[model samples]
Target chain A: MTLRGKAAIVSYGETPVTRARKDKGEPRLSYWEYFAWATSLALKKAGMTTKDLDGQGLAVMHPEVDHSLFLGVEVAEMLGVTSKWIITPSHGGASGCVGLAQAALAVSSGIVDRVLCVIGDAPMTYGDTMMLTEHRRDFEKPFGVMGPTSLFALVMRRHMEQYGTKVEHTGKIAVTQREHAVLNPDAVFKERFTMEDYLNSRMIAEPIRLLDTVMRVNGGSAFIVTKTEEAKRWTDKPVYLLGYGECNNYHHGSKALSDATLMGIGQASREALSMAGLEPRDMNFFQPYDDFTIAVLMQIEAAGFCEVGKGGKFIEETDLSYRGSIPLNTGGGQISAGQPGLAGGNLNLVEGVRQLRGEGEGRQIQGAKAGMVTGIGAVQYGRNVGYNSVAVLGSEL
Target chain B: MSRFGVKEGGEARKPLPYITNYSQGFWEGTKAGELRIQKCNACSHKQWIPKAACEECGSIDLSWIKSGGKGKVYSYSIIRHVVMNSMAFEKEIPYALALIDLDDGVRVVGQVVECKPEDVKIGMEVEAFFEDIGGASIFKFRPRR
Candidate 1:
């Protein structure tokens, strides 16, 4: 009943992160163009073409003018190909990873042989992000609580209060990720920063500083997934999805939700690892969504890399650099690499694939055979992320 | 439903709480200088904001019940930068917004006033107060003295 290794990710492609604007005379890309480039690059990397894709899915987390009524169909049409199944996932930041899971299901279940999982967002280039975020939220807008920064800040403060997690511990995450980013030429932020720089960074929301937040950028990433039998034809090393799990609205505003530091990632991660027949120790690396430094800290605890309420100590003792044990966000993550809207999930997901495929050059986790990529996003503004997904990937069975 | 767009003068007034028919009951209670929570009569389940059905049970027999307007600070964040309308919240530059765990067991978000931003702490006792702004009764919390 398990889809363990039934489907393999044959290739991954990502465009350089950019804030290019037509106004600044820099070349810019819409989500449409980004999707095209991302998917085509993935196919070309596998020595295949659009003709090989029998399933199509797009991850468009935020509203964009380029989005159509029928997203999957439009994506296929744009690629000038026909697909057996078309999928569009709306899991916020988890959208692209959810799309990958759906693509995996379609391929593993024999509904489709090869599926193209594409994700792109041009919020910076198009400026449609503010239009979508500002107008709605009858419940959210009035309180002067802006966006994720404000919302997550409460969670960060709660963590510090309840668990004694401190700025010194959380700031390490940004410092380590920036170090990894310095080695990644495609990373948006090239310069490395230290704990001192992190502390000195301007505070947007108390406890959540300028460095703790993910920078929004425009970019695209894609993966080509196929049944293992067909996957070998495309690449010598096909990264296999061993397991995955998702949960939403856990303990929603119930008495239990009063604890702002709580997250559903614990349940999701347990299910994924159990399905993979692996433990957290088996992962060669970890790459959870880093919309904020606190997010990565919370995931580290929820994913069982450390004990709950002990993330501070775990972070203090652990080496998070790319060359260190338990390598994390080797490609700089969304915090260091500019988050491309909800495509932020894809940035981590694709990085996991590239590392598994041994494609990570300068920032590669050496001898990395397996890793976990997690997706977390704001399903609602009230209490942390609503949807959390975990994917366990490996280079072999 | 109350008007949602920018008020006639635009940003001169504080933003109004988003009021829909589903949540009109809660707003009405707030306007009457009371804090009410949605309670499922069948399951005795308590909820916040407003929803059509009981979150715990499928009961539609939901009614507005008065809350003690007292809660403990579940969490709080000091907003140093303004992301909403500057005209509305700019002067208030750094303020403490909190998620309050109501004594009734439901959680809600409101700004914590009458205290320094740094003084806001988890488990701090607070009580709800209404702010009359732009003809809307906005619920905010202050240190319960």
Candidate 2:
């Protein structure tokens, strides 16, 4: 289905990313605590209470412990609403986008007029390092390949070999992202970073410097999806979903990931532009996932927003600072901004919505009529998880 | 069995349960300090980071195949720092990370150790050496024998 002229993001909400090692006087703040905080904030921002929710969608990883908890059902009972739809989706790191995409379809299809999508946790629980080892095959885990940093380092090794891209080139991305973070009041890392700071940072994985990797965070984030008519009922400004696409290629740590040029985002971006009847030049901002600095380079290139391997050049030559040139990752991204897993993913979407609605407090992208948000999933620290999802969002229905 | 128990035949080696599923073969090879990969019997495709299924054809027919354990370095990085504590690395910053293309058509990324980080180069011949870290033999690439 074209899914054109259908659904819009009426309200976006999130608890500012925080590091809660332990839930304030609660049991370890399991996934449920984070989910509740995020969902409640989103509903409040939409000018609704949990009681106003008509439907719900649960997005998360860890099917073993997380899936059957019936979070959507739990929320419905809390609100005393007869939910018309309840969904639980597992898409690894891209779970938040998966939830939003599902919410758009639910609203557009009239399955639900409004839906809640959320995720978050304490980083120490399932940080990137543990996920790599815990989810890894026992055979491979023993080789001491215990983290994504080394796995990504593996991929960076090949890219630098093939493209002659220097570590300094990748360092520029960290330096610039930190600069943007300085302007973000809510960003976890507001410290100013010079290229020297990036260069001097310790190495976590070969090509992935300490600054290049995103730190774990404890927090929650959420989004509320509703129909265009319903969005008008709740708020005047509604960010519409224009286009989306997803692809998977799970090579693990074996081969050089195809489309390493970071052009995969373009695949979904193309579909979005086609759906919205728009073009790259028409976009006012871009929010490519910044789990790792190199991943951003790959995503922007994949989105065709810039040339192949020229992501470094684009960030270096142009002023991506607020109101300088085109604004990219104005939220400071997962790199400089805190990445609370699912919450971090929603942070990008929330920033896109905030900018589109002109509510961004200080780091607003000026004249932002339309925006694009993309997510990369399943990539171990260095290897491609071989999955990509992109969404094009706009101010009009 | 305990990971600390020493093996009878090998050089005071302990009984470490190799990683199962796709990586069991890889870990077993490292214990012997010899690198190997699973080759798809159906498609003749060479695999690294061993998997139970073939990546190209999705076939389950696979066999443990030994590698020449020698390859050309495709690319490399000089590590200037270490975030996690390390006893193996004596230096402060500079280290080499290289992508080595095995003769079997499989390439893997690993640290190029036992030499000055600056001495590493692309296209240089290198071989695999097993480094014992915390009772487990980890794979690291080095200059050719």
Candidate 3:
């Protein structure tokens, strides 16, 4: 069931990430408008046009907003492209990667020849995040659970309790990613921060600090995928889709109980690696979906890059910069790059493709081949770890 | 009732819990000062989030049972800031919110009362106690004697 070498990412497009731009009162482009704009950019880079795309895909985490519902059906009306196969995933942060997986399956199954997967949102400009947290009000919010920082603070505390992980460990990730952000032209937070700054930063929740959180920005990213043969003909340096795995509402036991410190990536990554015939050690780079610093640590351990409870030591010893071993979040993960609503997952996925194509330009990982990109969905809930998805990609089949 | 937020006339206004038809019995049990959860009749699985059908066995045969209200802290987070998200908990800054693994093999989250955030431990034994808040019986945990 592996989608190996079936679909390949030939081109990618990204909009500049920004917060409330005072000069422009509010964003002029709607969500689908951003999609059309980014899609045009992707098509231009690929030397292709909308007529070449028979498949269309997008990610919408919450349909709480009216425009979000039936978004897939509206793509043709918005982009004016005829879509024979359409996919719209509702996996929250995981939606982008999950949509990629579904598109790959549809393309491989001969349902569609060329699929363009685009993810974009303007929560900063158009929507209120408080409206999206409605489901939590009934069960989790009744307690003192304020938001994500508060919930992840619980995970960090448990990790510290169980593994003795320290703030200094998470500081390394924050500091390094900000350094990467400095080189990223599109990153919102381009200022370099230090361990001292991360440590002394204001605590949002007791254990989670301001530096551990990601700021929302208005942005979009799109990637064009076609048959592997066509992609190779376009460029010998095509980024092949090797494997994809997704697990939702994953918890242990018939009771659905889970260790708050662990994510479902253990099983998800295993399935991905098994399909790709690759191991955790074989991954040339890591571009994991990082809404919080604690999440990156959890994903690192759960994906078996390091043993459980040893994420602290592994990160301490590894150089995560682009030039170093196992380059992580080289394009500045969502933590430092400014998360662009549901497009955050594709940000990492697109980065993995970019690095494999040797297009990292400023902070390139030398000789990068195979890499892993991960996603986490709806993490603040008390027990259930929402959707966990992994996409394995490489320069070679 | 504990203060949620202050109104103009020296009165408090707080966001109250929404009791649904599926969870009406659970809230009723809380009102009666009992920690109640649904236990599946077919598979004997206990769940904190009550529903119409059993999650494991798919049996609609469910019954509400009172738990012993005893558990150990599985994890906890100290809330040093609350006004940023909810103005109702503005006065309750620096409170400890804990995930408890109850003796009845279920997990629940609640605020740890009668103790400082510094006093909370990972494996501390705690017992559930009810408090009237926003016209609802919400449970709070305290260090057991």
Candidate 4:
């Protein structure tokens, strides 16, 4: 009934992160191509081929793409693999972790032996801006409630009012993550930024500056999940899925429930940690989704890293750098590394897996045995994220 | 000037929500200067933004009821820069967007007009006001004085 310790991620892969491809001169891949490239890399690393995959899960790339073929069926046909179980998750930023959790269930339930979960997107290629406004196209767009920046701005402002959180606290996250990005060769923005620079950045939405938001870029990431008993046959360094949880408290455009300060990540985190038989302190590192710095702060509080309304203080007093006390987003998160459309959530999930596998070359947390990754999705009423997913991963079973 | 030149008679080009059958009542109510929200008869739960069935008790028996339209500002944001490239809102550099928890217990999102962006704050009392833009009734909020 529970996926805990039953499935393991044997290998993971990612295409190079890039801003855009103006022409063939650049080494940018298409949305589908990025998925293929990452899948091939993961399969190779797992010492297997597409033929070995009996289950597949993919995240829908963009809304403009033709859904007549259905992403799930298209991917299976393109990969030349016949999957008995297939799904195309569309939970926005939470799709990656949601897909991974679903795949874990599929493999653990004896429905499939090997499951491949992938998410990728070329936002620059598709000209995809924050698409959450599409939820209520007419109602939100006319009023200029356009993107995630404004939505998160509202959340940040509310947080400030209730908790006395200031820009300095969030600036700390941006500054610290920039520092982490310097050590990550794959990071899009490797240049370090100071708190002053973050504070001085142009405001995209009031209470949310440019530095606090994630950059839209082109990339894809993937991982292979299999039964824990069969994981040893693929790789020696397998990261087991300790536990996972997902929650969608409200549907898009629904205003029945409104709590800007609470992103519903607490429920998901609590469920995951309880299932994993772990506590917040048990995490050697954290990879909370970082579409915005405020999101990370809220998740930290919701996940019980600190008490509610104390996230700002926690950020101020805690060290989030790679070698710091609480290693966070060691790969610079989506803020510095660039968000690849719906694949943004994978940026956190994959980084957690890599750290647990001892693969973080420069930003490795010493003796990291477990890590927590989180994802947020679907802005409610074009204001706040309403869905959350969290997973606990461990290096040892 | 209409709040940062965002609206000018009928020349403002902005995206508008298409009036569908399920939402026609809400739109019509706005045009008539009345705030309407769906109420589930089974559990008496109020809903906003118009949906097919009751979100609370999963009942399709719902009725459109007039709302008091008076509530406190639950949260708010000020748009310093426009994310969407709409000509109508391009010049609206700073506008207050607010979430209001209606007296009927349903939250609604609307722009806060007739006030400076900085004047908006959480817990501030507000009331819904309908604005007619090019034949479309768009609901907005204003600080209750």
State which candidate, 3 or 4, has the greater DockQ: 3
lDDT of 4 by residue, A12-54 (tens): 8888877776674666566788778888988898888887774
Candidate that would win on DockQ? 3
For model 4, the stretches where C-alpha displacement exceeds 4 angstroms are A21-24, A54-69, A128-135, A250-257, B1-12
Show where candidate 3 strays beyond 4 Å.
Answer: A23-29, A54-66, A130-135, A233-236, A253-256, B1-12, B83-85
DockQ of each: 0.54, 0.27, 0.59, 0.57
Runs of candidate 1 with Cα error greater than 4 angstroms are A22-24, A54-66, A130-136, A252-257, A379-382, B1-13, B84-87
Candidate 3 local Cα displacement, residue A266, angstroms: 0.9
Query: What does candidate 3's lDDT look like per residue over A1-397, in tens digits?
Result: 6787788988888887777576867554556666777778888888877767644443233321235566776776677676887777777788778877887887788877668888667766665552544447656676777777777888898899989999988999899888888988888888888899999999888788999989988777888777776786555678988887777777665354566776788888988888899998899999889989988888889888999899999999999889888888998899999998877878889889989998898988998989999988886355635889998999999
lDDT values of the candidates? 0.81, 0.67, 0.80, 0.81
- The docking quality of candidate 2, as DockQ, is 0.27
lDDT of 2: 0.67
lDDT of 2 by residue, A300-377 (tens): 666776776666667667766667666778878888888876566677777888899998777877788887887766
- Scored against the true structure, residue A133 in model 3 reaches a CA lDDT of 46
Q: What is the lDDT of residue A380 in candidate 4?
A: 77
Candidate with the larger TM-score of 1 and 4: 1
Residues B1-145 of candidate 3 have per-residue lDDT tens digits of 4333566565444466678888889889889999998999899888877778987889999999999999999888888776433666777877999888889988888899899888999899999999877578878899999
Residue pairs with backbone overlap in model 3: none
Task: Report the C-alpha displacement of residue A368, candidate 3, in angstroms.
Answer: 0.4
- The TM-scores of all predictions, comma-separated, are 0.94, 0.84, 0.94, 0.93
